[model samples]
Target: MSSRGTDVEDAVDSEVAAPARGTGTRRRVGYVAGLFGLLLLLLLGAVVVLVAQGSIAIPIGEVLRVLTGQDAQSQLSRTIVLDARLPKVVAGLLAGAALAVGGAQMQTLFRNPLADPFVLGVSSGAILGASIVILGTSGVGWLSGLGLVSQLGVTGAAVAGAAGVLLIALGIARRVGDPVVVLVVGVMLGYLAGAVVDMLVYYTDPDRLQALATFTRGSVRNVTWNELQVIAVSCAVVLVLSVFLAQPLNALLLGDRYAGSLGVNVRRVHFLSLASVAVLSGITTAYCGAIAFVGLAAPHLARGLLRTADHRVVLPASALIGAVIVLVAEYVAGGNGLTKTSLPLNSVTAFVGAPVILWVLLSGRARRQAG
Candidate 1:
């Protein structure tokens, strides 16, 4: 062949050998779209099912009415649906979403699919902080005498406690650089926090103890509009922070060394990730009381379902999945269809999360290091 003809043939062969980059980009976009669509459907379904199944048994019509701000048939009914049930549902939805998103970040940061917002003993620390406030102070003139500022002090303490554990755990993770080692470190921290809580409870006055114990078991029933406001402000702030965090977290998934090579500050990512986890876990634990395993399992489920480890995909997917799991859990825990007495939120979650724990361990994912 002539030289010009040979060059032309080689160019044709190269074009035929590999597809255009645009095709791969289009495929990724489609996959993301499908996962997002699934997430939306699951979120909507969860809202409907949970709203329909609460204790007072509001019909789906009334539930919709309340949600839409339409009048109910009776004043008591209106109050129940609008004021009581609505807040509980909203709280559950936010709590679930926040925990799941936080969990996803934690898993990526620690490089352990099993790592959750709670795993670093942050939740336990919050529980301890809240317990001290509730059990040691509520019975005194303290709660009655204190203004909203003082009341927030307790919640603030819970947040600080959670943040403290997160700082410590992240420090260890940075120093150690092994996911399993960090996981063990987190477990020990949690146990230590629990032991401290136990000692405090033993020393605490009996009247205060009763009120404080609820902080450990988790409950959605105590949510009033006042407390909701605090949760609202905090959740809003943290969630926005989370949205900005997605890209950095995704970079980290490539490993600290690779992320650093890409001009991503590994230390800064760790700092932000831990801070986000602290706020996310702290606020949820403060209100919900150490709800277990939602964080640990939801991200795994989201990743497995979407078949992608990218935080940009997994973060939002996990949030949607988390909301669904908790809403379903709330119905199960709330004595819908199965029994009269409502089961604890922790109990229902354990049933869902326990198997995930087993899988992480048995599948060797839990034992693997991020490095």
Candidate 2:
């Protein structure tokens, strides 16, 4: 690694380890447990409110009945809750958790606070892959007009695209051995991928663009239960895998050499972590259309609230916070009955993300490490 990289790792290691050493174990445990409990309750409340406040306006009681497998007062209410809002709400939940966990892993693996699938170009690659499939098939019709088989093809293409960018980024990072340079490279790759996508869009028939449009702005409303199965299975497996990597990731904070000395296979950890991030991000983007900022912002918020950088704590906390962020953003972006016209999920997410980016820049953490 470069001197700058080493310096940053040392700084991060100290900052991450100090709090754990200084605090009382019981007090920290209690705080973590309480925070987790509050987050779960908050998540539940968000789900209830989101389900209750859509266009049809189901009552909270009725929403609960539908959720708990009880009968609703009306068939319409049950249908709306079951067939319409429930899938969307669940999609938001899963997408948020997936992105946040992916973000947390990216930050650790790259040792860059700003690192994420969206910023690092992984999402763009997925977009490009999906676009190719969508536009290539536009000779027939838009994605919505296509059958389930074609949709699966698009999802597979997206995962391939994400994996492509990930491999390229990792290769360059290994050669450069500099976090800042890798970050810049990732950004450039994203732009390159985006430019290619734009060129494709420019040549394609405008009618097919309707389906492609949602791929850029992000949305969970259109995800069907079938797509949810793929997302749930992929995210669940990767999330559980992440739990196993927590200790190795913690060891890694101390630097690769030290981690190796402790018998952590740095190479194996990197492979697994990168693979997990690629899968989490690629799948989410394939279904949700490249949602942004949740992956970048949620981890920081988790670390701040928990006052630790341990992946075990940060990972789950980030997932919960991220889910809440998306759900709330969804509500703001026309999930509420008040808005007749809904905005894109990205538009709402940017409001939350831009401020966080500004704070990270103004805090001089990145700059200080680079210097």
Q: Top model by TM-score, which number? A: 2
Please state the error at residue 80 of candidate 1 in Å.
Answer: 1.2
Model 2: clashing residue pairs?
Answer: none
Candidate 1 TM-score over all chains jointly:
0.89
lDDT of 2: 0.89
Count clashes in each candidate, considering only residues at least 3 apart in sequence or on different chains: 0, 0
What residue runs in model 2 are displaced by over 4 Å at the alpha carbon? 1-23, 138-142, 365-371
Name the best candidate (by lDDT): 2
RMSD of each: 3.3, 8.2
Worst 10 residues of 1 by lDDT: 138-147
C-alpha lDDT of candidate 1 relative to the true structure: 0.77
